[model samples]
Target: MTNLMETLVENREMVQPNHANMLDTAHGGNVMKWMDEVGAMSAMLFSGETCVTARVNQMNFERPIRVGDTAYITAYVYDSGTSSVKVRLITEREDLRTREREKTTESYFVYVAIDEHKEPTTVPDLTVSSEEADRLRREALEGENGNC
Candidate 1:
């Protein structure tokens, strides 16, 4: 079993004009895509194999990110079962001109480990050894909302 702490991933992308909507703000779809990709990377890190998005519990966009801003996303495995892992994703936007940052999106995603055959595969147990992991675990559980 691999240690989940080493599987975390952070990815960032510049918000381009094409990634924005008519309002000139980063489109929700683009943000979701970024979250999904980062979550998948974390899943793959934990499983040491391919994984797929089984579900996204909730994605809330709190603010808008304008073009030329940098969208930073972080994904980490907070918990896991025999065949699935829970990933926490946080997205923030940084303005280059003002050198300011604001959290624009937050989401929790569940991914299922899969093998080359595209069948569900068992994953390594997630280990929470650091304070950050503990906090993330608690946050991920909040997404369960009594019904994961």
Candidate 2:
């Protein structure tokens, strides 16, 4: 069994000009790509194998991230099937000077573990070891605040 807590991943990227949109905010595609990468990291950790994105269930961007701000991303394994790992991803806009962060986006992605031949493979069972992990799993399952 793999503990959900062990598969958690956090990443941060400073928004650059190339990653910005017309309004000088982070582009929606850039943000989604970042979230997908983080989600894949979590899935790979949980599966102990290379994983490929199979689906993105829901992705909602609630706020814009300015070019100077940082995109702080977090992801964790919330559930799994024999060959698929389900991850919850969250993105926050972090103002470095003010040292403040605000939730900007939330999403759920499904990844399939792949073998050396690029065929789908089984993943170990998942478990939540702590109260916080349990809460996160519950929230993901419940689709609380429409973040699913």
Candidate 1 overall lDDT versus native: 0.84
Global local distance difference test of model 2: 0.92
Candidate 2's TM-score: 0.95
lDDT of each: 0.84, 0.92
For candidate 2, which ten residues in a row score worst on lDDT?
139-148
Residue-by-residue lDDT tens digits, candidate 2, 1-76 = 9998999899999999999989999999999999999899999999999999999876778999999999999999
Q: List the residue pairs that clash in candidate 2.
A: none
Cα RMSD (Å) per model?
2.1, 1.4
lDDT winner: 2
Q: Candidate 1 residues 1-148, lDDT tens each?
A: 6665687798888999999999998999999998999999998988887889998976778999888898989888888888998888889998777868888888778899888899999998777787876776777677566333
